[model samples]
Target chain A: MKQDIREILAKLGGLPVSVDTISDSADLYTAGLSSFASVQLMLGLEDKFDIEIPDHLLNRRSFASIDAIAETVSAVRAGQEAA
Target chain B: MDMQISLLDRLFDSGLLIDTGVEGVYARSGTFEDVITAFEGLIDRFAGNTGAEVIRFPPGMNRAHFEGSGYMKNFPQLAGTVHSFCGCELDHQNLIKCMAEGSDWTEGQKASDIVLTPAACYPLYPIVARRGPLASGGALFNIQSYCFRHEPSNDPARMQLFRMREFVRLGRPEDVMAFRGEWMEKGKELMGSLEMPVEVDVANDPFFGRAGRLLKNNQRDQNLKFELLIPINSVANPTACMSFNYHQDHFGSTWGLKTADGETAHTACVGFGLERIALALFHHHGLDPKLWPASVRKALGH
Candidate 1:
């Protein structure tokens, strides 16, 4: 899941630095991920994961890092399975 | 809500504003114009010595530049584009016929090269970039323009077409942030002189749709925007009379604006909503400018 998140970030994050160099907990915004790019990243993640991220999770903390995004994805997938 | 509507009605009845048969659109009387002119003079008194370049743009800007600004991406709901009837003679006849039939004649109108200027400082970015890299001391501009937004309301403060006076600063991030900070204080002082109630609070633009929620959150979390609020329509939900924005290389990267050292420039702007302030004064003081407090009149030089 972490590698998938990184792959998505590499494709759509528009980060200045390489995703490989960034730790799972590294702040994506600090690495030059713009608000515009973050929205793009969210859409890309939704498409790749086939899970709809709710409006409540659409926040800075949810997309703050690769680890954070992975956790959000898992929560969304878990909510879908329980339903 | 009743009080808000009455205020609009009173302004129209007092001849301070002329009713234009459209909500949020009104023609100002001469007295209102005088007040605006006097307030503008006061603004100049505060900021004129900064040696900022003065540039005034028309209410409409180049469509291509507006597209590049990414305004549509964020607030597509509020953007207004200029469209013209570019049909041939045959199509013109059809358009006339459509109009005569009391149908929608505007369907054939094509998009023009212009879009209503959403904010005063928007047109300045591309122009400044064309001047090449900024000087070591950086650049400051005094800009004013009639701005447009699509939100129509009975609240007189929320005009569909209004004027914005802005001071834009471009330089390193620290310089830009400092500029915004200085204006935030100056804004408070100016309002203080008028003896008006004011509060400064972190704010965000009305970014559009679901994705926009993230953008709005990030903006607030970063403290990128602030507003000086004054009660005009309601005290509980006061209107934003002034806004200070720190773009932090958003415009710099978009416009290719550069600092002297060849780094991307950071930009910040402080904007004053002229009509909103005038309305706030009337709402807080009195409908009659003559009856306004002596200090308030003196502050505005009325």
Candidate 2:
């Protein structure tokens, strides 16, 4: 799971990089995440997981970090499975 | 090989256009250069003979300015951020945690609220009316400004921060229509010149919920907003680029902008959503903007 998170981090180029260095609690936007790169991350999330993200969940909270995003993806997957 | 809309979203069911749908990056970078390029060509073709003098505006504005202009009454929802100071000492980290953990601070209320401007035109009225006017001639301005809105959607197409490049003129009603008319014709030509697959249509602002349903009717009756929509993600629901608006003495009366004869100078403005256009162009051409047609590349000066 951490490996998956790492790979996702790698794909997010032009973020204040060095995926090997940062901890989970670090603030991404204040630490220099450009809004442009965030869209790339969103697209990658949609394509990689092969799941649709609803409009309601489209916000900074869900996209803040690997931990937050992974939780969101798992929750979405679980919801899909439940249905 | 899939060519159906998402039944889940009625608007999404039309078709998904990927290129245009994805140019979110370019749009936020800045929308003015393209708008200016398009406007210059359009004005030369359409407004050249109308004797439109170009005026530039001061960047940014103050809250008192808008209050004086009645912006708070009409558009409270869309006002931008204002800077404010707590006018008190910063609490220690422990104090912050204590408050967070449900401990109340001693004898404290929060600071005052200053405001940011939401519209590009909010500051124009006060400046125009400052000299206690009676100039016989009408005024025309080419303004590019940073505009802010607290919109519901965070779609790249709908952004918190965006740029607006506008052609605004204050004159008689007939003159305002003539400017809009000239831009209307040139709007079609400019879209074609860029080879964007688009249509010109009337649109209403996302005013709100059930009440918003009637926006289209009102917009049509008053001819408020128009857009050139190129499908993003091939979705038939279009994004608005050019918005033409006529403020029939609403702003003029609020600010007391008067002509030599002492009537409110009719105000009209043509607004270009800079980022939206960049998105349209990026999607219409390829994402690798460097590889777009030479003419398009030249048109964008890229």
Candidate 3:
């Protein structure tokens, strides 16, 4: 999940640095991921994971890093299954 | 961006914009004023039979209303408040002394009851909410105001204080959506008549911070906002001359605005960036209005 999320970020993040240089816990915003790029990344992640990120979970912290995005996707997917 | 420098120079040289020695501030010449007036008249002609109630508010609005509008949470960086030197005699003396000494005299000023209006429609919702539920046909308002943003920029198109002509609709979801749709088309038609090549595309407000990114994306994903963009300075990056926005029930929910049927009223607004449009006209049509195409002049009633 982390690798895939990283791949998604690499594709849509528009960050200055290459994705491989950053760790899963590294701050994406600090790596030059802008708000518009983050939103694009969010859209891309939603498409790849096929999970709807609820409004409550839509915050900077949720997309702060690869690990955070993976956790959010897992939680949403888990919620979908439980439902 | 390079062309903008020459355009600004032309505006100043043509006396269309009076230089105020401020980066983002300028006074409009009479011809400039007439052009905006003609543009507004064209808007009126376009909106004919819409039965929109015309409401004009002062440039400043109640500070409390500004706070209640949640503008502070969203775009605090752009918000401007009215501050005055409300001090005692001794403080006033110190203020004078500071001014004479070339010190920060404005530091002695206190925040007043009003804030420079951030948008034309910010004051309308509370007033409408106070009137109870909307009528069956909903409400349509034609409002214009001098909006202020704290942003100071060298770009001539980006003025700190500018005018926005907006048509606001509040009612059922379908009604509001239809209103937005009709204006989006009418806006395109209006620009077409003026010979301004434009494209309407989905847009989002420059929402602030991390949470704002989500809001912006949600807005675009829901197709709530559309902007009619025209190339004034740069073709690669066009400017939004007009915007058609459907707020769904955001404002209604915020202000407890209800429909006659007792449900939250949906709201939408179409705003024309008056100065930007005028700048685009001068940019495309040249600095001289007389030299403009006869059709463009006729369309603008210039």
Top model by lDDT, which number?
A: 1
lDDT tens per residue, model 1, B147-259: 99999999899999999999999999999999999999999999999999999999999999989888888889889999999998888999999999999999999999999
lDDT values, one for every candidate: 0.94, 0.61, 0.89
* CAPRI-style grade of the A/B interface in model 3: incorrect
Candidate 1 segments exceeding 4 Å error: A80-83
Q: Each prediction's Cα RMSD?
A: 1.2, 21.1, 10.3
Pairs clashing within candidate 2: B5-B13, B15-B234, B16-B233, B16-B234, B17-B233, B17-B234, B19-B283, B20-B283, B31-B274, B81-B116
Model 2 fnat value = 0.00
Fnat values, one per model, are: 0.77, 0.00, 0.18
Model 2 C-alpha lDDT per residue in residues B1-302, reported as the tens digit of each score:
12222211222222222223422212321233444465445535544565554544444576667678755543457666454324344555545666788886533444234454466676677877896764666777766667777664425466555667778778777877787777777777777777887677776655443223333334454566666666654565767777777776667777888877788888878877766776566566754455779887665445
| Candidates ranked by lDDT | 1, 3, 2
Between prediction 1 and prediction 2, the one with superior lDDT is 1
lDDT of 1 at A60: 92
Better of 2 and 3 by TM-score: 3
Each model's DockQ? 0.82, 0.01, 0.11
Top candidate by DockQ: 1
lDDT of 2 at A5: 60
